[model samples]
Target: MHDRFDFLKNISPHHGEVLRNVLSKETRETLAAKLDVMPNGQTWYADIYQKAIYGPMVFRDPELNIIKTIEKLLPNYRILSDLYLEKTPDDQGFPFHTDFDSIGFMEHPEDMLTVWIPLTPVEEAGSGQLSIVMEEGAVRLSLIREANQLHSLVRVVDSSVPAHPPFQITQQEYDYLERTKVTPSLDAGDALLFCNAFFHKSEDVHNGKRSAYIMRLVRKDAKFNKTRLLALKKLGQNLAVVDELLKQHYPDAL
Candidate 1:
């Protein structure tokens, strides 16, 4: 049961039109033009599971004006990473990867939250929902930097704590997570807000597609400058220097 105090909370019947309209005119062009390039030879629409457009492009649109709404919703916090549209196709494999991998750039990475708002109807046939390991907000994941072997963007988190047997996890811990894992049934306008350090993955869809507008937030003074981040995106750095870029460009990183 994810209570208000827990990291996972679902709000139903959210602003459906607003959520649907997040893919503004500019975002559509970004996808159609295929301009933005991701690290390690990944483009905006490279993979079926994750077709992400630069979030700033979507939110900056004058018609939507989403930043104001987000600021109102989460007081004392601002958008850490704008918004990215992730469309998980039918039966795609989006394995449990590092949830807070990007948070390391934040001055207070521990104090961060991820908001996932589904754009697809839950009642629709063959809808793939997101599955997450539910836990308390106070929990924080212990991770080690383990480079991906395949030079791919997706990688696993190496925990200092005895991870799952598959990766340092004991039977007891795995059992608890197994009991706590939740795949919430959310509507097109529903939002699932969760914290860092938990394992989350996408399910398989049969007939329909799963799309969500995902955003990260942190305290207003969390040392994130959206304009600067957009500029960094303009720099067009590859994935190899990503860690260095964050550590050097971003202040006070541990």
Candidate 2:
């Protein structure tokens, strides 16, 4: 019954304003301007979800500063990935999913955290906002026991490829999620934090653009399971890179 979603209103309201202003001022030359290339196929903004480039104004010092700031906000966690720039129109959104298909062992899915920072407005039940099911942190611990029983099977299952067979919720599962779901109203600068295991998806953007920057971070106290990493490597995904990236971004975590 405990809700895992934590919404922080205006975590960086001024920073958000500064980002918009800076991007607007340098629109002509900055990659941020490439948003106009909507019909094109090459620019990052053309994609519904683009990974922020490191050299652009929105990404350069600004992103680094945000990373550092987030590090402060989450004192004991390690940054797991770079900023994912999500720019979706009123009609597009993602399906409900977790950070990954499986954690592969007795790891709690809540061990990881994903923070979403909106640059555009997001209203409850409005298009382009996020909808999340309120799941308690304990459910993941319970699921880990189920995962334990399936551990050996994962070692040899050819289909255990990291993303090959997507793990989507069944109708019954979704019904429960829908019953527990809540969509928080968020304006630019607000941050929504949630556990990796929570069932969530973006709402259909109905009015304007829903732009946000999302990234993942892991608890510093968590350790990577070697067996799981090996299982993923068999599937052609080098999960060791996740650890390496974490170390590179937050040396203190190591």
Candidate 3:
């Protein structure tokens, strides 16, 4: 993994207080209630499924103050997006993958970063633990066809007309994942930041509910094509308003 973890740690300050306030008992109860009604918001892939709730952008929410704090810590960068809450159970985990495929326009994938903050304490034995592999190792593995390429390769495979590579996880693949995966512990407010290119996954929730929020950030000079963005906006699915919002803030983010 190139020891890039230090860079991520350097950019983000200790925001345990802010995280605690945002995930306070009342907040968790309210969000949990929302989850009860919006189970469909959960995202499922292979071995893992998670309830994802978005927004309350850094511009409006107090918890988002972390953005500014991070900016100060890494003054050369700017946050590209808001946060996403992921709730998982002992039964929910994902195949190893990168987050780049889910977001659009990856012309320069390495420029992006994701900060995963656990809302509860996590341990190796815990159901929803984060797993990450070395970036260098993942890059080498990508060159070997038989290696498990859950994120990028999976997306390409899924996009094929007949979807050539089926989505099933092989036992060998699971064993490889188990061998490489590392469960990093985090208190309710601590966050782990890593490059988007990193191969990572989560363990199934076995005991307590695993709730986390992921925030995507990018450098200020990152290129975001406004025209293409508007074109996608015209398609007008769930992200139509997001296009309008981006245009308002970045005028050039189209």
Candidate 4:
């Protein structure tokens, strides 16, 4: 809808308790059991990320209280069909970056927001949690005016395995983010909804693990360059720019 960049909305004590069971004891036991059989450097939560990112949660109960609440808060927007899981095992959190977006917000940042709900909660003093900078309105408006394209990542390597992630920004920009960021600690039934323009990341976990369900909600009326996007095979035009990021950061990836 071409709106101003709204900061994160702390939505908690939601109907998420109902959703938590989906990742049940059976799920944990099954995943833990697989560790002996898993390949090197793999954790169960990461394994879940790969398997669930685009595959699990094919359907949602439209009548669920949480779903209805999200729908109400996000008028004129529709949630994407695929809901996925995020697992932050001990000692791992993500580098700061905005969306690892598929639709690629392009010229409209306000038209999209990420809905992050923790199935299992974390204390405010917890070791591993999400930290973000809720930029002031003028800076936010200006930043997203470029469609939130100029964003940064921390904890990324110049060259190594799993190197050269996409949607990165300049080091100076990254420095500003590091100085200004604050952690958002969620309760068991809590959900954190943040705008597409904001840059966020996970801090390394030092204790118990974290698991959450994440999904994207986009305005139904947002513009799309369907023909050209289709030509790029869904990676879209932004990916070309990412190639430079790869060369600059993880030179070995190319």
Best-fitting candidate, measured by TM-score?
A: 3
Global Cα RMSD, each model: 8.4, 8.2, 6.8, 11.0
* Comparing 1 and 2 on TM-score, the stronger one: 2
Residues 1-254, candidate 3, lDDT per residue (tens digit)? Answer: 22444433442222111222334455445544544464334233322344555443433345435556667656777666644455455344556765543444333555566767676676556547677664344434422322222233334423442334433445876576567555566666556666565556776666657776666776777675343344334433226334654666557655
Give the best candidate by lDDT.
3
How many collisions per candidate? 6, 5, 10, 1
lDDT of predicted model 2: 0.49
TM-score of each: 0.58, 0.60, 0.63, 0.56
lDDT of 4 at 188: 56
Model 3, which residues run further than 4 Å from truth? Answer: 1-50, 56-59, 62-64, 86-91, 142-177, 225-254
Alpha-carbon RMSD, candidate 4 = 11.0
- Candidate order by decreasing lDDT: 3, 2, 1, 4
Give the total clashing residue pairs for model 2. 5
| C-alpha local distance difference test of each model | 0.48, 0.49, 0.51, 0.47
Find the 10 residues in a row with the least total lDDT in model 4. 11-20
Q: Against the correct fold, how does model 4 do in TM-score? A: 0.56
The residue-by-residue lDDT of candidate 1 on 1-254, one tens digit each, is 24333223331112111223333455444433332353212443336445554333345445555578677666676664544444544435555544533334343344566767666655443577766654542123222221221111121222243433233445665566556666767766556665544566666777645656676666666564332233333444222333344555653532
